[model samples]
Target: MEYREVELPACKSIALIAHDNRKASLVAWCARHREALAQHRLCATGTSGALVAEDTGLVIERLVSGPLGGDQQVGALIAEGKVDLLIFFWDPFEPMPHDPDVKALLRIAAVWNIPVACNESSADFIVASPLFAGRSQRMVPDYERYTASRSAR
Candidate 1:
């Protein structure tokens, strides 16, 4: 496996997400953490972004709704190294129509070695960590080498 070091800047690009049932909690959390979160760039699916933005007054780049490929859009951002962290307030109990897309987004985050907060507690830990406002090194996929190896076969 190939790997490379990627640095997450002091000001990060964070993604916010929440299932419909948990949207309220996510919005509340955004409000509570507004001071800390305000220093970073934020993005989220359409409805979630709007709610969080309304509550926290923080600007967020809105993508399509998750069921309408928003998760994939976020995954694309992660893949392209545009997003540094993912704050997903997912409801574990729900069976979503776009379950595969959600999984794909989480999987891509893991592949990219970005910090992903699946719940409020996890989000708290990530935000409270020193790396939130400083550089943190993570190993990312060396896709170029992988592609070259595949092409040689």
Candidate 2:
């Protein structure tokens, strides 16, 4: 795929998502990073979002529950260039009914070059990077070329 560079704002728009089995871990992770995270815009899938809000008193733009289409909602935001970071704590041990959606969400994040963290250690590393608190640039797929080629097929 062809690529183009885009700038990420110093103050980012971060999306948080988690499966049922991973909610507590995500919420705890959010709480641990509450202060730093408070500086950015936050959005999340339903139940997890609510729990994070209640636990940390940080406001979150809550989408629908994951199985109820929240994954698609977040994916759309990623594709639209709205969300800069994705911290999805999904359960790999158990299969979810919406597994396909989960996979799609991850794929879209990658396609858009959004930073993502799937666990506590990864989250720690991501948030600790100097770039996390500063404006930076990333490479993303050149969607115009991709769309044109697809239409020609």
Error of 2 at 115 (Å): 1.2
List, residue by residue over 50-132, the lDDT tens digit for candidate 1: 99998789989999999999999999999999999999999989999999999999999999998899889999999899999
Itemize residue pairs with steric clashes in candidate 2: none
Q: What is the lDDT, from 0 to 100, of the residue 64 in candidate 1?
A: 91
Each candidate's TM vs. the true structure? 0.97, 0.94
Worst 10 residues of 2 by lDDT: 107-116
Candidate 2, residues 1-153: lDDT per residue as tens digits? 899999999999999998888999999999999999999999999999999999999989999999999999999999999999999998889899999999999999987888889989999999999999999999999989989999999
Per candidate, the number of residue pairs that clash is 0, 0
Q: Pick the candidate with the highest lDDT.
A: 2
Report lDDT (CA) for all predictions. 0.93, 0.94
Quickly count the clashes in candidate 2: 0
Q: Which candidate gets the maximum TM-score versus the true structure?
A: 1
